[model samples]
Target: MGKKSRKNVFTPEQLLSSLMDNIPDHIYFKDAQSRFIRTNRAQARFLGLAKPEDAIGKTDHDFFAHADEALADEQNILRSGKPLVGKIERVRYGKGPIVSVSTTKAPITDSTGKAIGIVGITRDINDRMLEEERLKSAQEELENTVRTIDMELNIARNIQESMLPERLDQIDEVKVAALYIPCSTIGGDLYDVIQIDEDRIALLILDVMGHGIPAALIAAMAKVSFTKHIARGLKPRTVLREVNDELIAHLKNERFLTVFLGIVDKARKEFVFARASHPPALLLRKRRRTVVRLSGKGIFIGFAPRYKYEEERVPLESGDIILLYTDGLVECRNKGGVFYGLKRLERLLLKHRDAPVDELVKRIREAHVEFMGDVPPSDDIAVLIATLE
Candidate 1:
């Protein structure tokens, strides 16, 4: 057998010294008086010391930025013999930037189980803390941006609603009732019942061809233009003709609207109306209990430069009801994609023919809600009910 050499074993102190020198984390031992008795190379480098021995015999109060707090924590662990595990600390040393550290401190016990000194290990967490702070700032900024947008939309909604006339009730010898519901914060539908003189009133209802902010803006422009024409004493057809020309001049990108303009002559007992590619107004006769659709051939406003609208005059008697609405009211869809058609609308009007204008509008709206169930409307719905009193 070959001669076997005796294997050398490292001494306990030598093994500990090797671990303290090689470990990446800062390691230190403090005496009972809180003086640094010994420290690893890593701890010395963290404190900007030339060598480990340079930190020996110095207390934490001499080097740490927040020394009083650090000393109090060390004293507590030494007196209670309780380990401080994973305590995060913020500190700066020797003019260096502030850093975050995860520190664990424990009592150094003698062989007899008596506490002698304090030993600690610290890991740098500056990079992780910095990243977390950045994320928190970004989240706060995003929330502020969302809040600002919500406020702007609310103001826009209020302005859009203000453009329509006040709730109609018995305007100029005619019983009037109306309802408006926008699918979003703003809508494209608009209506006005303007008293032109003591003997006549104009009822104008229009639907711009979309929803939201863009549609709302267009509707407002159309409302101003129509009001200007009315103030100029223009006829129903003349007013529509002027409005169509103005829209065609100003609007582009396929923007368009359908309009119905009607004038109720209380003295003449007649209703003269013009349609610009709009849904027909329903006429309910109380005596005959029959509904007649008042419709004519026309095109949508803002689509062409030169357009002519046909005006039709229907004789009106007391107790005759005229219902004007946007297509959203009749074309409302259910979950199964079925439309609340004109037939259903006419039947509802006949059912509530004798009811007051307000009650009639309410019941019809309720019937529509019941038909739709939980399905949301795809567009804005507006209705104007007029009874020749």
Candidate 2:
């Protein structure tokens, strides 16, 4: 005898029944009027029925609060002969709690290819929908918080800029020009030129240890202290000592500041300057075509209490230029990791030695920008140029 065929182990009806009852998703068939012809165990339990047979001959209106919309969707599927796939729906069953479901409905066609009814499968998606809604709400709140912070930062930037001098006044026999750029909305670099007496003027530039809000606050405090000491007719060294004491008292060695202060006296035709761990000032002699580094020894402010600062005196002549700047100018790097060192800046000054103070400042800035190319400076930059007539 021939071996029994595997296909004969179960009839088609038995296989269909097994599949419909085993799956967890709701599966059902509806007639043209949208009344249920048959339902699986899952669908019957979903409709609060004790058995699948009890769901027969019942319409969705008997068990669903929004049955009219479901009926319209099924009727459209039966008429269009097209399948509706993966549609998310919110439904209430017999006044029970609402639920989210992903549903697919297809037209059940006859041998003639005419749609006679609709076959549908639905899966519960209530938990997934709730999670997505919660995530969306959180994202909106985060975006709102970011916007508020940005607005406040802009306001802070404006206030910091306002603290700087609008323009440096030209004292007797001296002309001045300055430029400032911050790596961010606010920075730790500051510069000021103040008239000390009829024949003397004070110039100051300072750099805090870092960038952003903390550094900027320190810079502001240093500025206020420097100005107060200068107003009392203190010498360059005395002014630095007072400012250092003030900073040490407040910061307690938590931060540091580099400062260069100069007093230009027309009567003596000399520039008296002091340093606090700052870069040396450059003096460009137009007639001799020489650049001199006015170096002095001092410790950084806020590092120690009562740190004594020393002064250096350099003679000034007609057509002489004094360049004061923060380290950010020389420390700026290019894409090749090459620094725009002091040698390059000295060469630039020599090249523009004959240019006016304002023109020279402009040229130096342009050269720095060109050297950077697409690279951005990592710190704040400030330059002050004083020319003697």
Candidate 3:
């Protein structure tokens, strides 16, 4: 009973004072007239005061006197009758920037419920505020990068679309349609149709050999160069020859172009085609499929100074149409990492040979979506199809 009484001897107020003295934060008390009354050990240590006895009657402003800091602090204590928490302010130490602190001051009340002195606690928060500011700046920078990228992609898409012939306009006895999808903001797929003469229609599908904006830019350049060459009266293979040399001179070691150029003569029912290390076009004749996988025997242009390409003529029947494409369509991968490869495409073409060209395109795209199983297409997919007589 005596030992228990000894433990209970310290009152709640005595325990609270012990807590204030031991805590790492600064704690102090001021009288009704804003005169220093009591201060804890923690308060003296924080203020660089040598001893708590020395700090008891000395106000912090008089002891730490850097400026009118004491007057401002006393004014704040007087205005807030209740506890005022988390007021941030900078206090100077020696040199450099004065770090900031979060301060709380509560009015002390006597037994009659009248306010007397004030109890104040202060916590330093300079590091946290600086870290928050750094994070905000990083977020702003990231947002700016995203906006710039979106703008560039929109500009590239507009330029690419403008280069396309407004409409294929049902050729004399030919039905043609094209589709191009870029997997990224910008990519390396191109397809176009040109009216060469009343009887001849020129068609081309080109793939710049890479990815991203650089690849897309190169494809646009090829469109300009190819169109200019043809307008100057150069033939398909001859234009390809000049393009090959020019591309080699322009592109660095890592880039090249795979292009298929063809002219269809409606009156003669003839097709003259040239392939430049490109994947061959697929000829869907009624119920049969032939992959002209044999591109002309030459290096992929831009890999060397000169590469020869040969042109071949084939008599296209009234019911036959050809499909030209980039590898992205067949090379698209699934969640299991399996490619929708050449074998799969060959089977689908044969099965869907009787369907309308647009239907075939739509269905194949849908099938690719299902096969990929929530994964995006990994590259650009470009397709061009023309029915000939």
Candidate 4:
């Protein structure tokens, strides 16, 4: 080794000078009195100073005139006697907007390790902090919307539930089994049972030709009108007539209703059914162990200014069952987007025909699940399983 070179080993100041220039972060040294000692190129740029020399002896207050804020940070770092790391907000020297500065202030001690000064590194995290704030605001807005939707849906669900018959026990030699599942928080499909003079039982299944809150509103109105007209001893056809007029008057041109209304006479064991622009219903006869479908007639209610349907009668024998439903059952799609059509439903009905009302519901639900195979219900499903004992 050369004698002169060996004697001139690197000094602490030389090593620190090398470190300041090589570091990517904006690093600086401050005296015990909060004055700048040495700073890097990045630090100078961050402070909007043309050169490191311009910032070397200045304080944070000198660079940033936001007096109270700069003082608070200096006090915290000095009193803590430890590094204070956090986000500090400041309007950048010449930048258009306020910026978030992530800073770390470490204690630089002497030989005895007593604090002598501060060494700081800073970064501009304005973009990240702004993004976080935007996400927070969006999340809050979404939460607010969810809360409002929940409140509204809960009210609608309660109203729909109220419209349904209370005593699910049984009705006049017939046991009623029904299920209503909405694809969303609310649904457009509905059904109900009503007793007229203890002899005739009115069964109604209505699909409002659409989904969501709009359909629900129409279904609710139809329910109110049905109650009013049926109380006047109006037949199923007459009740539907009045309901159709009222719906056409209220609903928009694009909307209509497909419905099935029937009266089951306990004494006669007869079911007189009327339909309006709906799919066929299923009749499961325990005697034949077979399922039969009867298609509905006429256009959907609320379509034209006037519409009517003729009544059809079926002699309900012992163990005869009538299954009414919205087309949602057959129209339901799988993950592959293929529907579980009428044929599949008929076969499923045949397989579970003799199952009890509740069991039949379970079977139907299971079939729907298996058919859908991990897909969401494509639409609302409304089921009504009634049996003549």
**How does each model score on lDDT?**
0.86, 0.88, 0.75, 0.79
What is the C-alpha lDDT profile of model 2 across 270-367, one tens digit per residue?
Answer: 99999999999999988999999988989999898887899889999999999999999999999999999999999999999888889998998999
| Rank order (by lDDT, best first) | 2, 1, 4, 3
- TM-scores of all models? 0.72, 0.83, 0.81, 0.76
> lDDT tens string, model 1, 1-389?
23332233567798899999999999999988889888999999998899999988898877877888878988898779899999988889878988999999999999987678999999998999889999999999999987876776676677678888875524557878888877744567999888777777788899988656677788899999998997676788888888988888777737899999888888999999989999999999988999999997678889877787788899999999999999999998999889999999999999999999989989988998999999887888889888898
Top-lDDT structure, candidate number: 2
lDDT of 4 by residue, 1-389 (tens): 69888777988888888888877778988888888988998888778888898987788777665746755666666667767877575556655456787877788888977787888888788888889999999999999998987887877677666666666535667888888666765666888877776767778888877655576678889888887877776777777788888878798677888888887888888888888887788888778988877665767888876666677888888888788898888888788878889888778878877777778888888888888877777677888888888
For TM-score, candidate 3 versus 4, the one ahead is: 3
Candidate 2 vs 3: which has more lDDT: 2
> In model 1, how many backbone clashes occur?
0
Tell me how many clashing residue pairs each candidate has. 0, 0, 0, 0
Report clash pairs, candidate 1: none
Tell me the tens digit of each residue's lDDT in model 3 across 62-127: 644443765565566566556677878777643335777788888887797667778888787888
Candidate 3 residue runs with Cα over 4 Å from true position: 1-23, 40-42, 45-48, 52-54, 58-81, 93-96, 209-212, 231-235, 265-270, 287-298, 310-315, 334-338, 356-376
